[model samples]
Target chain A: MADTVATPKAHGHVEHHDVDYLHDGSLLSWLTTVDHKKLGVMYLWSVLFMFFLGGVFALLVRLELFAPGKQFMDAETYNKVFTLHGAIMVFLFIIPSIPAALGNFVLPIMLGAKDVAFPRLNLASFWIYVVGALIAVTAMVTGGVDTGWTFYTPYSTTTDGSVALMTFAAFVLGFSSILTGVNFIATVHKLRAPGMGWFRMPLFIWGMYSTAIIQVLATPVLAITLLLLIMERTFGVGVFDPKLGGDPVLFQHFFWFYSHPAVYIMILPGMAIISEVVPTMSQKTFFGYKATAFSSVAIAIVSFVVWGHHMFTSGQSQLAGAIFSFLTFLVGIPSAIKVFNWITTMYKGSISLQAPMLYALMFLILFGIGGLTGLFLGAMSVDIHLHDTYFVVAHFHYVMMGSTAIAFLAGLHYWWPKMFGRMYNESAARVSAVLVFIGFNTTFLPQFLLGSRGMPRRYYNYLPEFQFLHQVSTVGSWILGLGFVIMAGYLFASLRKKMDAPANPWHGRSLEWQIPSPPITHNFHEVPVVTTEPYDYYRPFEPSVKGHH
Target chain B: MWLFLATEILMFGGLFVGYGLMQSVYPEAWIAGHHHLDRIMGAINTVFLLCSSFTMVMAVHYASTNNKGKTIMNLLLTLGFAGGFLVIKYFEYAHKFHDGLLPGRFFSYHGGGPAEQAMFFGFYFCMTGLHGIHVLIGMILISWITLRTMKGEFSSAYYTPVDLVGLYWHLVDLIWIYLFPLLYLVN
Candidate 1:
């Protein structure tokens, strides 16, 4: 059966060649495309631009913190700058960075299908994202929200900025997320090619499957939370406002209830990228494949119960705090399982430190630190001292930026060839990776120390004692920005050169590599019948090219 | 459809949990507030929604059986009941408005039993208002399937739209069943 399925002429030889998805469409067509790949490309560019915008805000924040007393911008401007940085990065950039951008392109192809389950819905999600982002930018240009991205009550309700519009933008963005989740869930369930069982599917799909669950389950709560928040502000509903009959801590509970799981929504996709990258780069079958896959789901499940950990110092009862602390630590078990499996996959295996692999390796080190620091904050005693401090900021940045953003970069490089049919300048990419590593540590490592020494987060000014570490962190931002500039330089440079990449540049055994580099308007000539595991590296290289163009 | 429904449940679930927490916080206020909510009107609206759910199920059944006329008729009945539900809800809102039984800062009723009665009205308005929006959306969805049914677009083999809308209508009904007891029958 496997022999019969793998025949190159299984379909027919005289296949009509449609142009690749990128070239098939006009500008108008691109705007209205239902093709998964084209949508993915649009999402990729959109997120990248948002990343650049977010990075600028971050640079401004860091620049303001350079001397601490007064920078070019005053304190109110500093608040708005940091708020925009957090809002843009989380809502516009990181949340969609990997899944909606890269996953949209790859998941359908990986499933050996023409497109996602509902391509039109997929397109709708993208436009919805655009609308939401536009609204957010509108809010930014118009007074700008200073309530931080969390939009906690009392302050959020009282803030004079365009809090309502910003929250509405976030609300709209949640719809896009929900729609994408719905699309992915359907696609994964129904669209897998013949013989592709749940276990045989790629680990990245498992990550996405789990992420979609969280997105579907948790995002609606955010929608309602924000809506109720708007009500609290406008009508004085008092759900979150303490000046009325409301409890402000209840707002914290509501925010984190959705948000704590949201952290998984951000990271699980990153871990998913590593699951693919570590095995392909190491040239080894993934270690503890079942464990690694199940851990993704496990992390997602445990994520819901630990929202209270975020409110340890917010006047939550000791009993609830203790329970939350314990549940939070339980997350470490599944998370640690993944880290161990990734490391062991690389052990005694052929390791290639390509740009993608370098980023994967960085994810391991940074996520480990990030995950471990999270446990410290999870402990009720420690969180009291560290809560709302620079430590918390550094911890999240390490996870959100260091881990998820790095994994996104890894995925971008790993699939750049398949995505664009061009290989970037390797030396430059590797140099940028090293610079990012050095600069990231320099920027965030000192903040952990600064936080422990009683320096709070989101402060416009800092004490003289904190100025030196702050300056060092600011300097680190420059190196990080320079690294990204070089990255942009070479990647765009690769696009100009002709298509030089082979179908399987990394000799990856996945179904995606068995097809064309940039893949046709329709992904596969014939739907692939998977007869083996995705990471069957030990087997001889067999390109199951079903049909030729 | 189930996944989308899951999101809807969770969204309303947030409001439900908030309602319960605030109820426990101000039990006397909640009990006093419930007195203003006429159980008769609430029960009447509940019946309308439940009947609409029945009609919706029947519509789906007829669509799956390829009974186009019956499907359309049942769907129209569902829409009528949904409209009836909204009409009753409108009158309930009007009554509350007459008595100044408003939410939060707008609570102008001088005959309140507790100050937190305003908070009770807040939950009442927020929960019902959100649910009312869902009901309105459900009407639009039912109307859509009904139009499709009129065009003979659905058959025994392809009634997914009708079936999905039925599920949504049922959920909307189910949420109201919970809401009626929680809001109007506090005892």
Candidate 2:
């Protein structure tokens, strides 16, 4: 059956049908937009700005670690800086990066629908994110939180510097995450094109669907956890406080229960981006589509049980620790399945080393180190040694930054032309990609050794022997920073150019590529009926709508 | 709507788990704390919520059957029951405040059981307070749907708002079913 989604009525004044979402409205129109693409653009810019802020805090943390013993800031200031970095990066940037910014723009267009099932809710989620982010930044600027992002109890309860406000900020952000999850679940279930069955959809949608499940399910626990934390601090609620006859370790249990799954919330979307990029770059159908697709769901399920692995050294029971360790290992299987499928898919196909592909390839290498190192830490005996060391620090950055951030860049580059209708200088982007991969590894690889050598994290000073590795990591951070600068320069420069991209860049087979570059406000004028799978490269490409090549 | 409710369950589920854990840790305090909470008031509030949930279901049924008058009437009844529940809740809170049966450092009752009772009171206020807030929000939503029903905005074919609000009202009632036994009656 043919599907026809009525083009969204014009915002106010009637205009020609040819106007794209970008030009369809004034600046005022954007603030009041219910259009999914416009809201996505707004989210994109907001998250990008947060990325810049988080990156600056990361650099400051690195800069202070350059020589150790107060290179620029003292212990108190350093603690606040690092806490802000983790809080900003995790809450303000990474969680929303793919799902809110990119997913908002692409999910509906890919589903071949007019908009998300709840466009008004989508807009509300974006504004709530903004309000939450502003509150967090305000907390940062005014005295800042030193409890770190975890906000573990007792310490979080006693700490003096706006911890309540920051936790409140996180609580509000959790609501935004939950709303987006609700919107996406409804959209995916109810809004798919008439012919787009569950398995027939793109793997990226699978990854997103899995991530949304965790977001809806896990994030609420975080919301309650944070709210309880605020109460514990403000009202002496005595739930998580040890002095008040409460268990501090219970805070860890509560925090990690949501947080472990939250790491999946961060990584799954990144993996979703890789699933799209690897197949497209290979110019072949995904090698193990069903395996790859199912693995996303599998990972989401396993993530919930593995929160205990994070608390192995926090005085949890031996049996609980053992079970958590075993469950933690379970995460590796699905992750490896995905890694193997991406490799196999690219094994014999014609591969293009474009900027997006380069980032995808980098994700494979970085995530490999990131995912494997997790097993070492998952083993109770080993984690006992490396509990709070730089090793744990290095491991997460590999996953969060090296893998997720790199894949986000890959997706941004891959869809850049489509989103904005202008192509960046490919050679420049390639050079930046190389620098990023090199810089990212250089920054974190040494920390693995520092952590193994017992250089504890969150320390203001360190032994002289650890100094060399710390400096090395610091220099690596500069290289990473420079790579990102060059990327920003070229990407914004592309915006100056006119719309020069065709409907399908990279000859992608996804429904998103079937539409015009800088897709119209309503996406497809008429819904594209899907008959072939999203990555069916072996079959001749079918133009689902008229006026295509 | 079910997906949204799943989030709500998880949110409240965290609190329930925390309460159970803290209860195990301070059983005497939890047991003593229950003595202070008036069971009759708790039972009455529970009945109010149960009746409100029934009215909410009837409202949805009427909306689907195109009985606009009955839908509006049932919704108003649900709102009244919900408001009654909160009014009873206010009296319970005010009595606790008068006796200085507050959470944490504010526990100042002239007759005491255990110091850990402070933590019990903390969880008591938190759990019931959160539930009370949900009750308040439910009233507002019922009012919104009630107004819309009066405006002839819903009928047999389109009563999604009425239906979703009914689901929400049921969840609120369901949580109270758990809270009543755990807080007011459990030994």
Candidate 3:
């Protein structure tokens, strides 16, 4: 009778203390915490650390190439430098930057749920990521891999360095990615709050949902491809060795199968963050929300078929090349639609130049350039000229660095208060955003020109004629690096001092905005019953009785 | 579990894609390569895996219904079939190793065009070796499930583990079914 009794406290207040909730004490509480919010913050910090690490590598590469002729390192070291830059940036940083951190943190909260469907599996995914990263860093310290991240055959199989270690590391990392994908899929399917229909979900969730599908479907191919590479190195399996009559080109097919859609994996979450931030800051609903959501799925599917474009110069069939080229062009349409939708959302709206909005606008302009140049690369004739040149490097950076990195910054500024229960310096953040935009263009735009002028990429040194552009690009990288440091310093400083951030600081219309700052362990005190669409700016909630600046 | 099995399919799918492309380019070499593989051993392994699948399904069924004795009995039969499959695979590999039909540059088969022959065996070794690893892992999982079932841990209401293990067993069987025609009965 005592256990079954439901009674108020002696003072007439509800006894909320004995719920056996989170806030339980111990180091293991964090180490073994299945709370999605905790895991999300963990992902955020870890990915940010990796981003800085990868940025350090990028700066090292730029310093070495600043005016060519081995400014700081020899060719062998340059190869290792760029290889490390690519491996860390792609595998460790960009892919997980927004999705693993922001998506994991906010998705369940947005849906008004307590945690992801599979919480222990979420912990496993994070640990697996940590282990994979350790293995990669270990390989880096021991002379490093030289075959580049693509790990094309023959070279990958025959490389004398730590290819086995690197490939196995990537192989292990793929499982981590797959597990995260699995968790997201299961959570999205089973864990929406009452009354949140498919259409009413925020566009960010739709973006993550589409990205999860790609992560689940395409990551397995990379897992298998890396395994084969491991087999080739460890057991002398001749699957990709040309000398043994094995077709090295087949390895390219397998690698690109996962690697191409992998680009979408890197960018879609960033695009999703932009979709969320742009409309909220602009004081308008997202224009064509359904079209934007569908485009995420559309890009995922179409990206898969266009992987063959990577192998156009690798001796694939003419028919295969033409089909892939055509598909590559077609895939750009969804990306274009997303850009147009974001711009339309901002057209004549109360467009504020906040830090998050600054980053979002930058994402649109840079991703537009990145996506359009991708069409040129998708064209057979143009690609033949720019296949392995700095042009390709410039094209991807616009997408990966310019677009994804900018979106990552936008999301960071957008959700910083929610995650940390504090507000950062808005003016400083906005200044960094502008600096990053200018520095990013100055760094990459020259590479595009150099690439068009016949400057091949992946080489340690280049022709003397390209020295001026390389120097300018290297200088811009320092400015970009300085911008990142200033931004990081501002964020870190904000955390040390307590600054009050309200529950709905942005005055945005999303489910996550309804929750407490830094959220209680069980997210919502009561499950919010959704009745309207996510971005209903026209219908504002009652003005706050007690507002704080 | 289905998703893990799907990953395995794609793993083998990569090899199959390679094999298909190579066979199209060099049909004669592929035919000669096929002649070198021991069809009898391949056929025996195929039958062994198929029987293992049947026994695994039976084990799952019994475990689901809480028939502990029947579940253990069926699992032992499945494990036995897996053992037989591995033994056949070992002998087949031993024969190839003894004939100097190794992979890559270590290959020393006296047959003409040793490079092409090496390519054939390269795929053969990678596919079968990877599959063998899967079989080994499946046996461990099956054994764990068998022990758990003996403790009456599964029932109709809580038989997801049994069902997942059964799905895994069927996938291993399906892979062998594809492997038999491609490796042993190649046209």
DockQ of each: 0.86, 0.86, 0.57
Writing each residue's lDDT as its tens digit, candidate 3 over A500-546 gives 55555676777777655666778766777787778878676632111
RMSD of 3: 5.7
* Weakest ten-residue segment in model 2 chain A by summed lDDT: A1-10
lDDT of 1 by residue, B1-187 (tens): 8888899899999999999999989899999999999999999998899888898899888888888988889999999999999999999999999999999889999994988888889889999999999999999999888888888888999988888889998999989999999999996
Q: Candidate 1 on A68-123: residue-level lDDT in tens?
A: 68879998999999999998999899888888999999999888888999999999
Error of 2 at A149 (Å): 0.6
Give the 10-residue window scoring lowest on summed lDDT in candidate 1 chain B.
B112-121
| Stretches of candidate 1 exceeding 4 Å from the true structure | A1-16
Relative to the true structure, candidate 1 reaches a TM of 0.97
Docking class of 3: medium
Q: DockQ for candidate 3, please give it.
A: 0.57
Give the higher-lDDT candidate: 1 or 3. Answer: 1
Instruction: Supply candidate 3's per-residue lDDT for A141.
Output: 90
Q: What lDDT is obtained when candidate 3 is compared to the true structure? A: 0.83
Q: Considering only N, C-alpha and C atoms within 3 Å, which residue pairs clash in candidate 2? A: none
